[model samples]
Target: MHRFANPGRFLRLAGAVLPWLWATALAVTAWGTAWALLYAPADWQQGETVRIMYVHVPMAWLAMGGYLGLGILSVMSLIWRHPLADLAARELAPVGAAVTALCLATGSLWGKPMWGTWWVWDARLTSVLVLFFLWLGHAALVRAFDETERGARAGAILALVGLVNLPVVKFSVDWWNTLHQPASVTRLDAPGMHVDMLYPLLVCAIGFSLLFGAIVLARTRSAVMERRIRALEMARARRADRPLAAAPATLAGD
Candidate 1:
């Protein structure tokens, strides 16, 4: 684990793997979309509107999963001082927030036809909204301080505290009376969805998960490179300044 934490080593592995990840993600996601949108059996009750599940369900799952990841990264940052953890978490939040927002947007689109409204204060919906805000908050807080370490520490703390909401979001529908539907894909006894629909949904979930990883890894790589460049520039500037400082002392001595 420590071996993988080195920024240089991580960057090398990411570069080698990212192309494959992107290709696989695109192929799988396209196949899943094709299956879901065209061939998969629509719900007997909901008919064509059920098609939204392919996109919305994946987004919903990713949103929660991403937050869980952020929490883990936070734990790493706080406990082990994993060198890359802070940077990874910092890169992850915006992507997570974007995914969460898509979940909310897609949910609204799905809900309007089913529930006859664009918004609600239901437990599940509200908890998810909170999760979205938590993502945004981490993203913002991490950059708020001038000192990067201080910002990272603050963000890690916020991420750890925000993890309490995960269970609440997961169980909200079961725990409270809400228009939002219960878990179908992740049901304990058995999946509630039909095999045909379920297969494509699973494919989409896997594909998007890959895509999420690719995006985060790409962003982190860029960040590492950028920071390295800035450090080099600062070092060069200091080196150039040293000559000027020495000249004044030499002239005073003369």
Candidate 2:
């Protein structure tokens, strides 16, 4: 892990893995989408609207998972001064935020049909909403400082602090009376969902995870390249600023 902190090594590893990641992500996502949309049976009660679960659940899972990863990376960056960890955390923010937004949007879409409302202030929903804000806040804070190092440090601190919300998001439904359903797929007992619906959901979740990995690797590679280019440019500018050594002095009228 520490050895990979070098940008060049990280880039090489990222390049090697990215193509396979992308291919797997695309293939599985396509297959999962087809299976869920075409093959999975409608819910006995909710009917076709249950199909949205394919997208909604995966996005929600990733939203939280992505943030948790970012927070862990933030800790690494702050504690060990891992070179690429901050960059990786920075790259992950927008993707996580987008997924969180999708989760909220899909949840609203599902809620409108079943709950007869587009929004709710239930504990689970509200906590997830807070998670979204935390993503946005971290992104903004990373850019707030004039110095890049300062910004990264500040963003890392914010990420660690924001981690308090993750538990709240996870346990809110269990702790409070909410419209949101309790844990079905991750329960202690057998999953509540039937195998027909469960299999495709698992496929979609794996695909989404792959997709997230591919995107983060690509983005981190780009960031490493950008930093390298900036360093080279600054070096060139410093060279240009240095005065040339005075021309060899010849003895007067040798």
Candidate 3:
């Protein structure tokens, strides 16, 4: 992990891996979408509407997974002072928030047909909404301070603090009576979902994770380059501000 602290090395590694990541994500997502929508059998209960699960479940997983990543990065940044960690966390926030919003939106769309409503105060839904707000709050905090270091520290703290919401989001369905169903793919004994539905979902989840990684790496690399440029410009300006060395006094005798 410390090896990746150097932005140049990280950038090189990212460059090498990005193409493969993007290709895998695209290929898997395409295959999963086709399988989920076209070939997978409809749910016995929900029928055609269950197709939305492919997109919704993956987005929800990534939404929570993204924040979990952010929290870990924040810890690395704050405790170990990892140079790239804060940048990665900063880049990840918006992506997590976007996915969280999509989760809510798709869940709502799925709900309207099955639950007979577009919105609900269910524990799972409410907790996820809180997670989304936490992401927004972290983003705002990261930009709020005039000093970048201060902002980063503040954001890191916010991120760590917000981790309390993660378990709530994960276990809300079990802890409270809600319209949302309990865990399907994750179970102590065995997955509740059928193999037909589960396979495509697993594929889609992997694709989403890859996509998230690619986006974060790209954004972090951009941030590092921008910071490097700013540092160079500052160096140039400092040099420009210095008085030109006094011309050496000419020796008339020479």
Please, what are the lDDT tens digits per residue for candidate 1 over residues 1-254? 88988888988998999999999989998988898898999899999999988888889899999999999999999899775899999999999999999999999999999999999999999999999999999999999999988999999999999999999999999999999988888887999988999999999888888899999999999998888899999999999999998998999999
Q: Model 3: which ten-residue window has the lowest total lDDT?
A: 244-253
Alpha carbon deviation, residue 26, candidate 1 (Å): 0.9
Best-matching candidate per lDDT = 1
Residue 251's lDDT within candidate 2 is 35
lDDT digits (tens) for residues 1-254 of candidate 2: 88878888888988898999999999999999999999999999999999999999999999999999999999998999776998998889989999999999999999999999999999989999999999998888887888878888999999999899988899898888999998899998899999999999999999998998899889999999999999999999878766443223333335
| Model 2 misplaced stretches (Cα beyond 4 Å) | 244-254
What digit string (tens of lDDT, one per residue) describes model 3 on residues 9-66?
Answer: 9889888988998898889888888888899999999999999999999999998889
How many Å off is the CA of 30 in candidate 3? 1.0
Error of 1 at 116 (Å): 0.5
Model 1, residue 187: displacement in angstroms? 1.4
Which residue pairs does candidate 3 place in steric collision? none
Q: Local distance difference test, per candidate?
A: 0.92, 0.91, 0.90
Q: How accurate is candidate 3 locally (lDDT)?
A: 0.90
